[model samples]
Structures are given as structure tokens and as C-alpha cells.
Target: MNAPYSRDCGPPPWAGSGGAPSPRPRRVPWLSTLLVAVLVLAGSGFAAKGQPDRERLDAYALALLLLGTALLLARNRWPVASLVGTVATALVYLGAGYPYGPVCTPTAVAAFTVVVAGGLRAALWIGGGFLAGHALIGHWLYQYLPPTGDPGVPWGREVVFAAWVAAVLTASELVRVRREAWARERLERAAAAKRRADQERLRIARELHDVLAHSISVINVQAGVGLALLDSDPEQARTALTTIKAASKEALGEVRQVLDSLRTPGDAPRSPAPGLDRLPELVEQAAGAGLNVTVETVGVRRPLPPGTDLAAFRIVQEGLTNVVRHSGSRVARVRIGYEAGRVVLRVDDDGPATGSDAGGSGNGLAGMRERAAALGGTIDASHRDDGGFRVRADLPAPVKETV
Candidate 1:
């Protein structure tokens, strides 16, 4: 799966300071930084308006405001601490009777900081504290400091300003939260795509493994027998040579498909998958491997349901392969029949029994059973009292109505 954005696409617009790509629950610092910048500009502009006699504009006031604005940059990272520091410094300026510069710019950064990190609840409390502090200072100036330069308000405007502050904080935080949600969605889609790719690769691996694993095992056995009999028995050697040739051909075809998968973008487009019609070829291969494979038809061999054909084909193929590998039996029988709205396949071996072969836990039988169950069918496998291993599968074949 690809990353959310390509290298050519670049990072999103909201990416914050430190070039941190948008995180889920976006921790973007730009909006917060903009808020601080605006407040700094506004405060600087307001402070510039009421200059103390140019002679009295000292180094101390310049030092405090510059330090406060610089501190605001760290707001998102340490909201509570930054807010506390900004609030403390603002209080000192306000206490000096709204001295010659914009005193509330630092407060704007503090208020916005609380909203972004701590959310609306924190904003409410922090905004309330700011307003309360201003009202108290305003009242103090009116009552004792002899009213410095027309600070006018009927209490309602103060309430409205407080509401505006809350709205701006909430709106900015909402933007960050939404960007985070979008990042999460993109990440989830990427993960889901990766999982699907992995599962498909595993399925292809299983198919390639089942196809060549069994065929090569047969070829190995026959090649060894052919080498042993080359000097002692010419006819037997020749027969084994023929078996090796047939196994090699089948293995080569299966390997070609496996390698083709790597070159193809995904599943290769080719002929349809092998199905019931190909069962005869599989049986012939087994027969060539020196197994006397007999096939019988007990019911109508009509066109089967689409999915049923492939399932039936794999059942027969695996069954015959198992017989070749595990059954020391020289003779095997395959019976295909239709009865009671279902198709049945029964492959059994009647030969000398090797205890290891007869007593084995067979994944071939298990896979057939699973396929049968998925089709609303059934499967049964057992060793007969007559010393034969049998596999039976019943697949539903509901007749289609003529159109």
C-alpha cells in the first residue's frame, strides 16, 4: 500500500512547526502560532498608540513584552505552563495601570493556548479568570487610580468579548481535531490494503506449494527408482523414465504459473482454472506413476454448477495425489456419482498398507472437507476394514430451471 501522500504530493498545508506531518488528532502548531502572532501584532499596535513620554519609555517594559511574545510560541507543547507564565506576566503589566503598550496580546496567546490543548472546558475557566482579573483591575483603577484614559464598558460588552474569545478558541481547536481525524482515516485505509495484499500472497503461496510440492515428490521417487533399475532391469527403468518425464512436465507447468505471478501485477489473466473436465489428466498422471487408477461414473455427467466444478476438480486432484504419496496401494478407485440433488466423489486405495501412510493425519482430506462444507455439502474419510483408505465428498448440485 502507498503512503497517504506521494513524495511528489508533498505534506499537507496544516503541517505544524518542526515540519511534523499532520498527526491524528492533528497537533498542528500553525493555527496556534498565528493566534500568537496576531495577538503580538495587535498588542504591539495598541501599545504603540499610547506612548509614555518618549523619554519615559524605558528598557524594562520593552523587555517584558518581548519575553512574553517569545514564550507564547511554546503554548501547544506546554499549554498549562505557558498559559500560567503568560498570565503571570500580563497581570504585572495590567497592575501597572495598563501601561504604555498593548497589555492583552499575551493574554490572547494564553487564551488560545488553553483552547487548543486543554479544549473548551479549559478555555472557559481560563477566559473567565482573564475577564475576572481585568474587571477587578478596571474597578481598582476607577476607584483608586483616578481613571487612566477612558476605559468604558457597561458590563455587557465585557460579557460579549468573553464570548468572542471562547468562540475563536473553539473554532481553532475544531480545525485541529478534524485534520487529525482525516489522518487517522487515511492511515486505516493504508493498513487495510496491506492486510489484503498479504492474504492474497499467502493464498498464492499455498496454491504453488500444493501444486509443485506433490508433483516434485513423485518425480524424486521415480528418478531414484529409474537410476537403481538402469543396470538390472531395462524395461522397468524405461517405465520409470516415462513416469519421471510426465512428473517433470507437470511440475514445469505449475512452476511457470508460480514464476509468472511475480512478473504479473497480480493474478495472471489466462485460461479458466482447472475443473472437473481436467480430472482425467490428473488420473492419467497418477497412472503413469505406476498406480492403477480406475475411474467410474455412476450418474449423469451433466454440466455442473460453476463453483462446484472447480471444487470437484481439486477434490479429485488432491485425492489422487494423496494416494500416490501415502497409500502404498498399487491400485486406486475413483467413483463419481449423483444422488439426491448432490454430486459425490469417492477415491479409495486397495493395496499393501503402510502403517505410517494409513495412520497419518491428512491435510488433503481436511482441505476437501472444508471445501465441501463451504458448498453446503459433506465429506467423510476412513480406513476400510478391507485395508483401504477412502475419501468421499458430497457436493450440492441444484438443477437450474430452464429459462
Candidate 2:
């Protein structure tokens, strides 16, 4: 099954300073930074005109405004420094008795950037200190500061500014949460795609294993017989070669079918999948490998779903092929049982284990198990107690959905 995708290997866009490192170096947001600079410069000129009682905007004031906005370029890489720099510039500009309007915009922007970079605590501390300093200078130090005979700023205005600060922090936190959620969703989608790709790959591998393993086993035995009997029994040699040709042809067709499905997954196969209906062919293939297979059907036969039918066919095929390749016995038994709500297949061969066979748990048995497990079924292959090896599959065969 596919899991959610996640990557701790690379950093996100907002990462830096107190946050994660960026996957790639972030480019400066030049246009937006310059726009903020222009707005601050224009707004400060207008504020100076309106507040005739305050110190007029001058070269020093222009330097402060530009410096505050300039710090924004480094906000992503050094958010904590940017926030502190901008906030301090705003305080110096205000401390010099220039009119209050728009001086805090750059500071607010920098603070928001800090929060986005996961420096929430740091932003809070800097913002809190700025507010405290402003309160002290506005209500207490006004007489000694710039414009003469001026009373300090009112408590009501400070309260409003505090509210605005809270709103900026709240908005920044919300944006951070939303960005993280979007990242999580993307990771999940990628993980799901990878999982599906893996399953399809495994399915193709199983199909090829079942198809080639059985056919090659038959071809191997027949080639041996043909080579040995070429001079002594020409007729038998020709017949063995013919069986090899048929087996190879069948293997090629199945392999091509599997590949065709891969090339055009939405198209129907050129041939239907082999089911129990092809049991006779499997038995015949076993015969060409010089083994006799006796098939017995027990209970009432019923139509099966496509998945179960194919699993049943492959399980039986692999079981017989195993007997041909591994068992010393010349005969194998196939029993198909149609019970309540399920179909059972059992293959057995009388054998003292072959020297090269380690209880036959190679790719073929594993493929058989995979097919059965895919359909919520179970497979058991083991050396039988009564001097034989047996492979059994019990698979669910539910009736049609509408029924």
C-alpha cells in the first residue's frame, strides 16, 4: 500500500535563520522590497507635511526609511536579524520625532517574515521590546526628545498599535500553519504514487515468473530427452522438440500479453487470462515434462471472479511445475474443491526430497503465495507427512456483487 510522501532531505522555501535550511538558495524578492521602500518614502513625506509640530523629514529620516526596507531582502535567510534591524530602525526614526504614520510597516513585514521562518518566540520578544520602548519614549521621555513643548502620545493610540501587532502575529501564524498543511498533502500524494508503482512492478514480476518458470521447466526436460534420443529414437526426439516448441510459443505469448498490458494498461488483453479451464493445458505441459497429472474435482462447480480464477490457475500451474522440476516422483495429484464461499486447490506428489530442492521454496512458490495473498487468500506449501510434497491454496470466491 502507498504511504504519504515526506522529505526531510530538503528544506522548504520559508526555512532559514531559526528555521530549516533551504533546498536551493532563495533569490531576493527585489520588486516587492523596492515597492515597500517607495511606499515608506512617499508616506513619510506626506506625514511630515501634515505634522507641522513634529521634526520634518530630512536626509537622516530618508536613510532610516530606506534602511528598514532594505533589511527585507535578507528576511528569508536571516529572519531574526531582519526583524531586529527593521524594528530598531523604526524606533530610531520615531525617536527622532518624525511623524508616526507608516514608519512601522517595514518592521511589521519583517516580524511576519520571522514568524514564517519559525521564529515565533523571537518575533514576540522583539515586538514586545519595541512596544515597551515606544511606550516609554512616547509617554515619559517626550519633553527631552525632539519637538519642543509637545505632550507625549496618548495611551489610546498605543493600545491600538498593540492590537495591530497582535493581528500581524496572528496572520503570520495562520499562514505558517497553512503552508505546512500544503506540504504534508503533497508528500502524501507522492508516497501514494510511489506505492502504486511498486505494486504494479511486483505484479509484472510475478506474471513473468509464473509464465517463464513453467515453460522453461518443460523446455529443459524436453531438450534433455530430445538430445539423448536424437539417434536412437528419431521419432521420439522429434516429438520432444515439438513439445519444446509449443511450450516456448506459449511462454512467449503470455510474456507478450503481460508486456502489452503494461504498454496500454487501459486496453483489454488480446487473450483472456488462463483459469481452471486451462487445467488440461497445464496437465499436458506436465506430461511433456514426463510427469502424469491426475485432476479431481470435488463439490459443485461455480463461476468465479477474474482475480480468483487467475490465482487458481497460476497456483495449480506453479505446483505442477514444481513437481516436474524438484520432485523425484513421476506422478502428481491435483484436487479442486468448491466449498461454501471458497475454492480450494491442492497439488501433491509422492517424493523423498530431491537433492537440489530445498523444500521447493524458490521463486515459483513465492509467486504462488503472492498471487494467493493478493486475493485475500492463503497458500501453504510443505513436505507432506506421508512421503510427498503438497502445495495448497484456499481462496475466497464471492458471488457477483449484484447477486
Candidate 3:
């Protein structure tokens, strides 16, 4: 149950006149309260029968039991108040010469509620004081306070009462600790789910950016060529239009694959992911866009991890796309290196700077970096001393163990 509000019914002091109404309070826990009341009253009546020397049961005794039950019903919303109320009623019942039975049950339940509601220190002080005061009344003051000529109780009974109080407090602390653990576990699960969603969003953005950027760059160059050659060189214009068609088709296919994966995640992909194995297609596409590309290999030839291959392909693709859009030179070179448990890729262009052209260099570069970083790799891109641009990436590519 939630915490209690003020006794009077009104909006809180902090709420504005036009603000939302206060949250509805939970109803008092009636069923459990009724059960405890029945048990306490019946058990005391039975004990009173055996303890004939004690003052007989009266209307005041029954009222005390009912009041204790009422206090317990409010325990969830007002634990401290419940603890104080129940403890006071129990003390009064015992001091009035009523025979003890399960009358302390309500106070014990309220004390447990207090500890679990983060009022441990308060429950300890009040509960401890109640036990001490009752012991004083029963052991020393009973001669003057109640049933006349009654003898003072033995010291052993006081020890037993102290033990009962200790047990209740101990049980409350254990339950409090368990509730806190469950609350922490729920929070951790929510945070983990949020993190997973964020990472998936980032991955989707990178995939869409890479697919659209490279393909659009090619289509842009081919369209310009087709427009220039349309009248004088009809055949060349036809070839340019053909390249545009091909580039657009490829972009659409890759985008469809991404969407299909999202629509039915964890299923086998209908098409293979693009990697260094598709380098020849990349080279031909660049040629269609009027930029010549060369591919070179060094060191041992071996298969790369799937993540490493994908990152390397995207890095080279972004690098050449940058060259076509920004560099004055039309020629680019790609170099692939296989070394000790790692693969390296480098793309270069020889150029005089062209400041007028604007492509998505920012998103392209950042996407490449993110892709490399996701696979525990790194990318570096900068201008060459020979007035050219170059992009280099180093990615881990440990060979899979053979069976």
C-alpha cells in the first residue's frame, strides 16, 4: 500500500488550483484485521477462563482488542502511527488486570510493517520502550495498579517477554532486507532493457546511413553524366542511366534486407551481408561513376571474422565515396593487409582540394567510426601530405579454430 495523506480531505499544499486531483488512497485492509481480531479476542477469553485470579473480562477489554485491530488495518498507510497505537492499547489492556493471551499480536504485526516500510529505527525505540514499560508495570507496580493484593511476578517472565520482542524485531529486519533485494532486482532489469533498445536503434541508424550514402553518391554522379551526354552521345547517356538503375536497385535490396530482419528478428537472413568478398562489385560500381579504383593485398590470405569483414568493407566504401564527392582526383586505391590476428584496410586518393562540393562527410565518417568501434576496432581518416585524402582502419580478425 502507498503512504498516508493528511487526515483532512483536500489537495496538497504544493498542488495548484488547476492541477490534477490527488491519487486515491487504498482501502483499509479489512479481512486480515478481522481475522486477527477474532483470534486475539477468543484466545484471551479462553486464557481468562484459566486465570480466574485475574480481573474478569469486561467491555473495556473487548474495546481494547477492537482498537488494536483498527490500528493494524492502517499499518500499510501509516506504519508509525499503527505501531504507536497498537503498542499503547496493548499496554493499557495488560495494566488493567486483563489476562494475557495473543493480545500482543497486533503490535507485533504493526512493528513488522514499520521495519519493512523503512522505519526500522523508530520501531526499535517504540517497541523496546513498550516492552520495558510493561515489564515495570507487571513486576513492580502491579500491587498498586490493578487487582488488589496481587503478588509481583517472578523475574523469569520478564526475560521471556524480552525474548518475544527480540524475535519480532529480528523477523521484521529479515523481511525488510528481502523486500529491498526484490526492488533492486526489478530496477536492474528495467535498466538492462533500456540499454538494449538504445544499442539496437544505433545499429539501425548506422546500417541505413551506410546503405543510402554510398549508393546515392554513385547515382548522383551517374545522373549528372547522363544529363551532359543525352543529346550528343546517346549511347554513353544510355550507359549512365543503366548505372543509375543498378545502383538504386542494389540500395533498395539492402534496405529491404534490414527491414526484413527487423520484422522477423532471429530468423535466417534471405541474403548474405556485404563484405570484402564483394570488393569487385564495389570496384565496378566506382568505374561506372567515372572514378577508377585499384585493390591490393599484402601478407597471408585468410578468412576474416564476419564483423571484421563488414566493418572493413563499409570503411573502404565510405572512403571512396568521400573521394568521389570531395576530391579533385578521379583515381583511388584500396590496400588490404592481413597480419598477426588483425586486418587493416586503407583507401587513398591523390587530389587537389575541391571546396565547392558537399556530400555527407560528417555522417559517413562518424558511421565508419561507430562500425569499427562496435567490433573493437579503430578508424583514422585525414588529408595526405601529397594533397590527397586517406582513410585507414585496423580491425581484429582472429581466424576461427578448425574442428
Best by TM-score: 2
Winner by lDDT: 2
Q: Where does model 3 exceed 4 Å of error?
A: 1-31, 356-361, 401-403
Query: Which is better, 1 or 3, measured by lDDT?
Result: 3
Prediction 3 global C-alpha lDDT: 0.79
Q: How do all the candidates rank in terms of lDDT, highest first? A: 2, 3, 1
lDDT minimum window of 10 residues, candidate 2: 1-10
TM-score of each: 0.71, 0.88, 0.87
Q: Could you give candidate 1's per-residue lDDT for residues 199-312 as a string of tens digits?
A: 567546555655665576567567777899999998998988888888888777766765666675767645466678887788777777667888899977877887788778
User: What are the runs in model 1 whose C-alpha is more than 4 Å off?
Assistant: 1-43, 50-61, 90-124, 138-149, 264-268, 296-312, 335-346, 350-387, 392-403
Locate the minimum summed-lDDT window of 10 residues in model 3.
1-10
How do the residues 1-403 of candidate 3 rate in per-residue lDDT, one tens digit apiece?
0112210101122111111111233456666677777777776787677676677889998999899877877887888998899989888887887775677778777887778777889998997888677777867788777777767666766776677777777777887798689879999999998998888888778888888888888999999999999999999999999999999998899898767768655798889888899999889888888999999999987888777888888888888888878888999999999988899899999986687565564788999889989888899988989899889999999977889
Candidate 2 residue-wise lDDT, 1-403, digit = tens: 0111011101112112222222244656676677777777776676566577778888898999899889888877788998899888878877788765676777777777778777889989998998888887778887888978767766876776687777778778887788789989999999999999999999898888888889998998899899999999999999999999999999999999888768755788889888999889999988999999999999988888989999899899888888888889999999999998899999999996676742333788888888888899999999988879999999999856663
Candidate 2 residue spans exceeding 4 A from truth = 1-28, 357-361, 401-403
lDDT of 1 at 306: 70
**lDDT: which is higher, 1 or 2?**
2
Per-residue error (Å), model 3, residue 295:
0.8
